[model samples]
Target chain A: MLGYTLRRILQMIPVLLGATFIIYALTFLMPGDPIAALTGERPLPEATVAQIRQAYHLDDPFFVQYGNYILGVFRGDFGIDFFGRPVLDLILERLPVTFALAVTAWGLKLVIGLVIGVYGGLRAGKAADHFALVFTVLFMGIPGFVIALGGQTYFGVHLGWVDPAGIRAGWPMAFILPALVMALEAAAGLARLTRTSLVDVLRAEYLRTAKAKGLSPQRIIWGHALRNAMIPVVTYLGLSLAGMLGGAVIIEAIFNLPGIGGLMVASINNKEGTVVVGIATLLVLVYLVFNLLVDLTYGLIDPRVRI
Target chain B: MTQLLEVRDLRVQFSTAQGTATAINGVNLSLEHGQSLGILGESGSGKSVTARTIMGLLDMPPAKINGGEILLEGEDLLTATAKRRRQLTGPVMSMVFQDALSALNPVHPVGRQIGELYRVHRGYSRKAAKAAAIEMMDRVRIPAAASRVNDYPHQFSGGMRQRIVIAMALALDPQLLIADEPTTALDVTVQAQILELLKEQQAENNMGLILITHDISVVREVTDQVAVMYAGRIVEQGPTAHVLGDPRHPYTLGLSQSVANEDLKGRRLPAIEGSPPDLLALPRGCSFANRCPLADEQCSSSAPPLESVGAGRTSACFHSGKVASNVAYSN
Candidate 1:
């Protein structure tokens, strides 16, 4: 198991390199000079523009600029943005808001998905199972942004149940709508996956053995079937963490929240290459770490996976 | 000895897309305290279904107990409430299934799997359950029971896993243990060991046993009486020695002929011709009439009821006396 984990960690190096290369290459291929964009529509002396380009390594070849950026990253320097602010500090300041939204959404999805899934799986082909199946399918079919908008109008404007937009001192209530909207689609998929996987596991021979052992229905489901069924669910949950981070961009934009995803999008529109690439690198790191944790969890949930 | 389990005219049917298949039809079985009954049959002969129905493990929508009575210690299991059945399962009777690896929960440790019986039914504390698990493991002859108890199902070898399954089944000392093809998934040497362990345990506990297997030698070695089942019905049943030595029903005669005999080592072993009858559309007369060499107009036109032969034997064949004499002369 340790060997497998170490090997997986080593495998992440190329994925990280590829991610950094893509982000760097994308900025390089962008039309017009970043320094010119930085200078905006105001006219400047040719020497001043050239000096600005040279200082930012914008005057160098693509490979040279990319190499220099990679070196800066290794040295913990994400470089300065258009406003002369350190991109790392900018990302750090915005990290908490994004983490709060994504983590809460992930938590909501996990809990709700698992509950619906287990209920549906245990009572398969019954009314509860049918309801859960149809509910998840409907949630999955609708887009997340639509839900966010609809929720804001219904829960915030019409019902006055929540603020619907913006973080307040009592942020938990403020986060509810956005977080729930963020969770809906993923939770629906998870609920379906959980239901199917649990149904399959419940049909396994060991559950019959558990029943023959005179275990209560609760013990058989929770103690025996649920543990084995959660293996695939854990993998999905880990992958969903990466997905939630990426998904937060549109959700944050829709809700007008100041999370990293929103920051990345704003930077992209402004062609602030440093901030965009810096945030992209952080996301890539998060993706790699979560995948590694998922692999480790496989061993924890199923002993056979350790080999 | 008092009867421990009495199954009278048990009929089980499954509603499939094809049709309503009668898996077990008009099966009558009874076991006394400390007696072992080996139910021998080929694949798809309803051996496992019978065991599952007896344990109340079959799901009702697909599988229905069309008609029957399963009386455990004079209490009808069919009418028993779900809670009452659950209460009776672990302490009153339990079953060991085929395929030990799949039979034991893959996620739990062996000790925990065995200990769960006591924890759920008896409400044993974790410490006490663990101790009892070790003791059961020791009884099943799993080496280093104290240390190995913590190991998961995958950690143990197949035979050891099967032993763990048996240990779990008999942990609460249930009055009856129904092992459904328990050794079918084991190596020959390991099969012998498991059978021996089961026999010893049954003897020690004075519990009734139902050993279901396709292997004739296994049945002969472990059971006092044998019932030959073909297409959901018992073709013949009697003391093991008497039945195997001189089979009455043509189906049982054919089955005994299929077994490898040292006296006929030089020649090809005989096999029962034709496959088992289709369960979805069984013959109105006798299920095995198509395959029985002695089958005639009477055999094909009407099903023969189980009739008494001499010496506490029963055979469901019109020509039981003739077939037994023919088999005797041939031997």
Candidate 2:
């Protein structure tokens, strides 16, 4: 197991490197002149323009810039933002907001997914299964941004319950709408996945043997079936976590929430190349880390999954 | 005589794309305490379904038992509540399935799984359960019982896993054990070992065992009574020795003759012609009528109910009323 894990970590290095390259190249091609954005147009001199270009290494060839950035990664120097702030510091500041939103959404999805999945799986072909089917259809039929809109109109505007337009002081009200939207998106897929996995696992011969041995339905489920069914959910959840931050961008925009997502949009609109790159890099890192955690969880859930 | 288990008019139907199909139809059987009953038939003969129905483990939506009475020690299992039915399983009754590899959970320790009967139903603490598991492992004669207790199901061979299942079944010393083709996946030697272990466990606990299998020779060594199933009903049933010694049902006689018993060598093996009928489109007559040598016009129009042929034997055939070995009828 240890050897398998070490090998997996080694295997991920190239994947991470490849992802970073794509992000770097894609950002460069996005048609933004960071030098022009940073140095204002009024009475700007040619020498100052060249200096601005040199400062951010935009004057260098594309391959050279890529090579230098890859090398700079090892030295912990991701260069400076358009406003001259350190990229790392900028990323660290926005990290908590995105983390809080994604984590809360992920947690809610896990709880709701497991409950619906197990219930539908246990009483398969019954009302629970039908209810789960309908619930999943309702959420999956709509996109995250749409649900965010509906939730704001119904719960925030019509009901006058929540501050639909903006994220407020405390963490509770701040995360409510964003988390709900993300969960609605996640729960739809998860409920369907849970139902399929639960049904399959419950029908396994081990479950029958457990039944033949007179173990209670509750014991069979909690002790054995649920653990096995969590495998696919783990993989799905990990991939979902990677995209969690991205999903909040539109919802955060509608809500006027000054979270990392809003910061990302503002940074892009302002042509803050360093901030955009920094946030993108942070997302890539989150993706890698969550993938690793999922691998570890697979081992915990079933010994057969070595890595 | 106190019957340990009785299954009367048990019919299991399945709603399929074709229509409602009866898998087991009006099957009647009885077994006494401390006795072993062997149910032999080819695949899809409804043997496993019968055993599953008796255990109350059949998933109900697609599988519906139209009518039946599964009386286990005078308790009607057919209408029993889920809780009551569960209570009758494990220590009271258990089953060993055909495929051992798939039967045990791959991720859990075999011993811990075996000990779970005590842990879940009996409420034994983890440590106590572990100890009891080791003891049960030893009783089943698993080598290095203490050391191997923590080994997962995949670590054991096919035969050994079946023994673990048997040990698990008898751990709580249930009154009845239903073994559905327990030796089907095993080699000759291991099959013998498993059968011996099961027989030992049954005798030691005074338990009644219903062994379901497609192979008749495997059950000859241990079972006291034998029931032959065709399509979805018992065609013949009697004391194993009497039935094997002087077979009555044409299907039963043909089945035993087809097998290469020691004395029946040096002759062309009498193979039954044609395949088993599909339950969905089964004929209205005796299910075995097409394959029977004694089949006639009367056999094709209507099905025959199980009728007495001897003092303690019954067969579902119209003409075979007397135990005449010379009676010959062939299609």
Candidate 3:
């Protein structure tokens, strides 16, 4: 197991390098010069532009610039944005809000998805199951931005159940509504996946053996069936965790939450390449880590899974 | 004493997209305590269904017991409340399935699965259950039961897994053990060992055993009495020796003749002609008529009733005498 973990960690190096290169390349390829855009209609003098560009190594070829950036990253340097604030510090400040938002959304999806899934799976073809089917389809069909904007209007504006916009209230109060909207699509997909996986597990021959062993329905379903069913669901959940963290940009923008997502969007618009690359790198790290954790969790849930 | 189990006119039907198929039609069976009965049949012969129905493991709606009385120790299981039936499952009766790999829950440790019976039925503490699990494992002759207890079902070999399944079924010392093709998935050499283990356990517990199998040799080796089923109905039933030695039903005779033997080496073994009838659209007469060599016009016109042919023997055929003479001449 230790050897496996070491190997997996080693494998992440190439993936991280690849992801960083892609983000850096995309940032480098963005239309409009950051230096020229900074001056904004009042073009910077040629000498000042040269000085700034030289200091940042902006005139270097793409691969050379990427190599320099990677070296800086290895030494814990993410460079400064156009506003002179360290990109790492900028991301760190907003990291908590995004982390909290993503986690809240994740928790919401896990709970809602499992409840609906287990309920529907056990009572398949019944009214509740049909309702779950329709509910999942409805949520899955609508785009996330639509749900966010619609939810913001109905609940935040008309119903007056929440603040219409912004995170001035802070913490849970500000995060809940947008997180819920963010959770819906994933929760629906998860419910469908969980339902199908659970239904398949319930029909497995082991469940019959469990029943024939004289286990109660509750024990049989929860004990014998749920763990096996959860194997696939856990993989989905882990992938979605990475997705929620990176994909919360629209939700954060709609709710005006000062999270990394909103920061990324603002930085992208302002042509702050450093901030965008920094946040993308963090997301890549998070994706790799969560995937590893999911693999580890498999061994815990199923004894047959060695690692 | 009341028979260990009694099934009187038990009928099971399955509703499918195609149609309602009578899987077990007018089947009757009885077993005395400590005796072994082999229910011999091919795939879709409803032998497995009969075992599952008796165990109360059949899924309703798709499967329905149209009419039957499954009596366990003189108490009709058909009329028993769900809760009562559940109560009887572990202590009164239990079942071992065909494929041990699929039958044993893969995620759980083998010990916990076997221990579950004690934990749920006997109210044993987790530690006590673990200890009991090891004990059960040892009884099944799994090597190093203590160490292997923590291993999952997939960790064990096919034969070892079946033993674990048998251990779980016998955990509470149920009066009856229904082994549904328990050795079917095992290696040829391992098959004999599993059968031997089952027989040993049955004798030690004095448990009524229903060994369901398609293998004639397995039946002859393990069971005292044998019932031959065709198209969901029992066509011949008697002492295993008598039934296998002198089959009264043509279907039974065909089944016996099909078995490969030393004498039949290098010769084309005579196989029963035609497949079993489609249950969804069964003919009004004997379901096996199409496949039976001795099938006459009368055999196709009317279904034969199960009737006494000899001491403790019953044959469902209009020409049992003819079949017996044929068997005698062949021998």
Candidate 4:
């Protein structure tokens, strides 16, 4: 099992490299120069432009630039942006903000989704199952941006329960609305996945055996059914967490939050390519780490899962 | 001996898209203390349904027990509270499934799964149950029971898994052990070993055994009496020695013929002509008329009740005596 996971971890390197390489390549496709965007329309001398270009290595081949970026990522050295701010340092600072939001949202999503999903699944073919279906559908149907906006509009802006632009202060109460919006959207899909998985698990012969042995429905679900059902849910959660970056972008945009996703957007808009690339690389690493954590979580759940 | 279980006129039905499906119709049987009764039937003959109804495990809406009196030691099991019935499942009665490999929780340890009855019913502490589970595993003759107790269901072989299920069933020493094809999942060699273990356990516990299966040889090996079910009802029932040695119902006779014994090898095996009647679209009266050789206009219009035919035997047939009365049905 150790060997298998070691091989799996080793295999992750190229996949991540390839993904980042493609993303970086796509960034090069975007029009306009970072230095020009930073220091607009003021015509600089060709030599001064060359000096700026050389510093950022615009003269280097795309492959050579990619190689240098990969090496810099390895050494934890993301160079300065056009604004002359340390790209790595800024990203490291902003990362905790995103981490806090994502973690809260993830926690909410997992707890609510699992509880409601397993509940609906156990009460399958009943009113509860129907209700869960409708509820999840309603939540999932709306776009994340819309949910975030509605949350900010009603809960944050009018009622004054929380701030509309999210917490400049790292307070827990500020987390409630944005985290809830993210959670609501995530929970819809996660709940559906959990419900379907749990429903299948409930129908498994082992569950029937448990029932026939006279276990109460609650005991059966919590004891026997939930553990097995959560396997698929775990897989979905891993993928969802990997995709969490994309969601964060929209969420950060909505709440005007300072997170990796928020930083990504700001850097892109301000032509801060180094910070953007650095954040993208970090996102890839987080995705890889999240996947590994999920693997280990699954191993913990099922002892048959060695190591 | 005192009666442990009495199932009378138990009719189970389902109102499907294809009309009403009579999964089990007017099936009657009984078990006395420490005695064994085996029900043999092909698939779809409602053997498992009868067992499920007894356990009250059938999901509502689709499955409804239209009429029945499932008396366990003179108390009506059908009318018993769900809680009471559930209470009795582990304490007074228990069932072992056909596919032992699938019948257990795959993720949990086999010992813990088996020990749940003790934990749930007897209030055995986790540590105590763990120890008891290892002991139970040892009783079932599982090798290295103590160490292997933590192993998952997939870790064990099919026969060993069946033994584990048996261990679970026997853990509480329930009065009745309803083994639904207990050895069906096992090989022939393992099958024999399981049968021996079951018989030994049943005798020691003085538990009434209801071994449900399609194989005549398996029933004959483990059970004292045999009931032959056809088209959701019992056509004949009596002592296994006489019923299997000399079957009364044509279905039972046909079943006995197909047993591939030395005496029947050369004989052109008389297979049942058609599949068991579509329970949803069952004909007006006797469900077996289409396949029964002795069927007439009267036989087609009316279903026969189980009437006393001979010494210790009952056959549900219009012409029970006119046929092979020499085929004795005695225990």
Per-candidate DockQ vs. reference? 0.84, 0.60, 0.84, 0.74
Q: What is the C-alpha RMSD of each candidate to the true structure, in Å?
A: 2.0, 2.7, 1.6, 2.7
Candidate 2's docking class is: medium
For model 3, state the Cα shift of residue A23 in Å.
1.9
- Candidate 1: Cα lDDT at B224: 92
RMSD of 1: 2.0
Tens digit per residue, CA lDDT, model 4, B1-331 = 4579999899999878878899998988899999999999999999999998898878777899899799999889888888888899878998999999889998999989988888999899999999999999999899999999999998889989999999988888899999898888788999999999999999988889999999888898888998998879999999999988877776787677665657656766557667788988778777788876667898789888888878989998877765555332211
lDDT tens digits by residue: candidate 4, A67-102:
998888778787777767888889888777777788
lDDT of 1 by residue, A95-206 (tens): 8888888888999988889888888988889999999999998999998878889999999999999887777734578778888987877888898889999999989999
Q: Fraction of true inter-chain Cα contacts (below 8 Å) kept per model? A: 0.88, 0.73, 0.90, 0.78
Model 4 accuracy (lDDT, Cα): 0.84
> What are the per-residue Cα lDDT tens digits for candidate 2 across B1-331?
5678999899999999989878998999998899999998988899999999998789887899999899988889988898899888987788989888888887888988988988878899999999999999889899899999988887888878888888888888888999999998999999988988888888988899999998888768889999999898999899988887777788877777778756757766668888888899889998888877778998999998888888789888886744346444332
State how far residue B94 of model 2 sits from its true place (Å). Answer: 1.8
DockQ of 3: 0.84
Ranked candidates (DockQ, high to low): 3, 1, 4, 2
- lDDT of residue A11 for candidate 1: 97
The stretch of ten residues in a row with the least summed lDDT in candidate 2 chain A is: A35-44
The per-candidate count of clashes, in order, stands at 0, 3, 0, 0
Sorted by TM-score, highest first, which candidate order results? 3, 1, 4, 2
Candidate 4: residue B183 lDDT (0-100): 83
What pairs collide in candidate 1?
none
Q: Chain A TM-scores, all candidates?
A: 0.95, 0.92, 0.97, 0.94
Instruction: State the C-alpha lDDT per candidate.
Output: 0.89, 0.83, 0.91, 0.84
Shift in Å, residue B70, candidate 2: 2.6
